[model samples]
Target chain A: MPSADEIFAGLMQGAREEAAELWEEAKEFSINTCWSLASQLVLVGQAFVAGEFTKAEVTKYLETIRLQFIATLAAALMKVEGLAERIVNAALTAVRDAINGALGFKLIV
Target chain B: MLRAIVVLLVVLVVSGCSSFQLGERYDKSLDDDLSAFQIEAVTFVASMRLNSGTPAGAFTSDAAKAFYPKASGTLSNIVVKAGLLSSRQCPINGIANSIGLPTIKIGGETIAADTPKTVVTGNCAVVTLLALQNVLADLEASHRDHQKIGPIRGQLAIDDINKAVATTLSGLRAKDL
Candidate 1:
């Protein structure tokens, strides 16, 4: 027999929980991106160390590095597939408001 | 005949100098590139961090100003020195240079030093990326109880930066984008 306010609160809590869950996923994707880029860089280094790279080879490797970072960050936001942009967006909104409060910005709609 | 030969030799010698032909990448530029990459990587991580206010896709909007080629300079230097980021490389004489490796170029810049002309490599942006990663790891390790951005929970300001870059590249793709 929860009161009206209690029911409203319950609904709000559920929404927040859902938002948090979505944010968690986007965050994980970002982390995995960082790690993967780092790992790929190491592999490129190994190839270079082994005297296995030509001038063209090195250029290609660097291109890959640039692309990975661009792709990872872009994918996180663009919602092209395999990622939950909505969750990330929701979590980020919370951060923006907090940052605005702490940092003291005149945020508009 | 002797004069012609001397002229030919000089041409040969001059053309072989990689430093003369390549872009003058200073420690500053290398630093700039790696810092940009690190910032991109971390901010993306930040979205998953302790952000309670940031909206989805807002990471870019929030970070657009702070995200750019100029902003990530110092962080990149640290990463390259640390060997944490190793993928970004430079192409030399048709070969891929190893990333995250340290290199001191006394001869690569267009503003030449008093040294012999050579395609000096190492200590590049890729190397800087690695070093920055180490700094990040250490920072993460030391601040075991901080409220800073977690591994994947922080709002990484990447979208804004990437969009700007992508737009620029799309314009320049045919011209080596």
Candidate 2:
């Protein structure tokens, strides 16, 4: 039978790899969104200065962009938070199961 | 017509500048929340370490004795880094102030103006907390299965561990706000 320690070691190794992958994904999404928002803002500013857009039109455009940026940020943050919670819960359950399997005692959380 | 163009230019520049400032403020707020979560994590890990005192006798299996301390140390280091990231002042705050930009000190050491650092730090805390919980679980299990190995002094109760984990997890969630 594999020792409880060995089981935990293996589980944690897997958990770390998973966490790193999630982090990288979030990072990429954030960078892309920031760049896109900046580009859109610059284009809007250029149009406003060129008199192509009225002040009211520029205001509406900026507001829309702002709202979109906020939404994207909120979604990304939620995804990362959810991932963290899942990782923690999964680790606890895995350890509990490994120990129970090894010792044959029902371990209650 | 020229006057109107200049007026439009000023409006555009001011509005654009203000929007960026607002974004920076939002990012700072998020960073502050992440720092708070990091502190909470550190406290929880410290409590776990305190509860896991050296037992009177050796563990029954060589693996138990070898892995327990190693896992504990690894968890401790992760918590420390998270704490540092939270408590230190962001290097960007000062630079932003000098450049006439609105500056908010979101306490943390991260690449300048990077909000993803907060998410990364929070995830790191989660990973460490989970690993610590696993180690504690393994120790408790080993103690239960091997009576001859004797008791681990100050060994944490399962209830206490569960409670701490719950608290830490909630704190991490709260940081999303």
The global C-alpha lDDT for each of the candidates, from Candidate 1 onward, is: 0.35, 0.38
TM-score of 2: 0.26
Local lDDT at B4 for model 1: 75
Worst 10 residues of 1 chain B by lDDT: B17-26
> What is the TM-score of each predicted model, taking all chains together?
0.21, 0.26
> For candidate 1, lDDT tens digit of each residue in B21-70?
11112233433454466456555445534442344323334443243323
Looking at model 2 chain B, report the run of 10 residues with the lowest lDDT sum.
Answer: B17-26
Local lDDT at B162 for model 1: 42
Per-residue accuracy of model 2 over A1-109 as CA lDDT, tens digit each: 2333443455455545666867565555544544453444344444334443334433333323332333333334434555654554454455555655777886433
Candidate 2 backbone overlaps, count: 0
lDDT of model 1 at position B141: 31
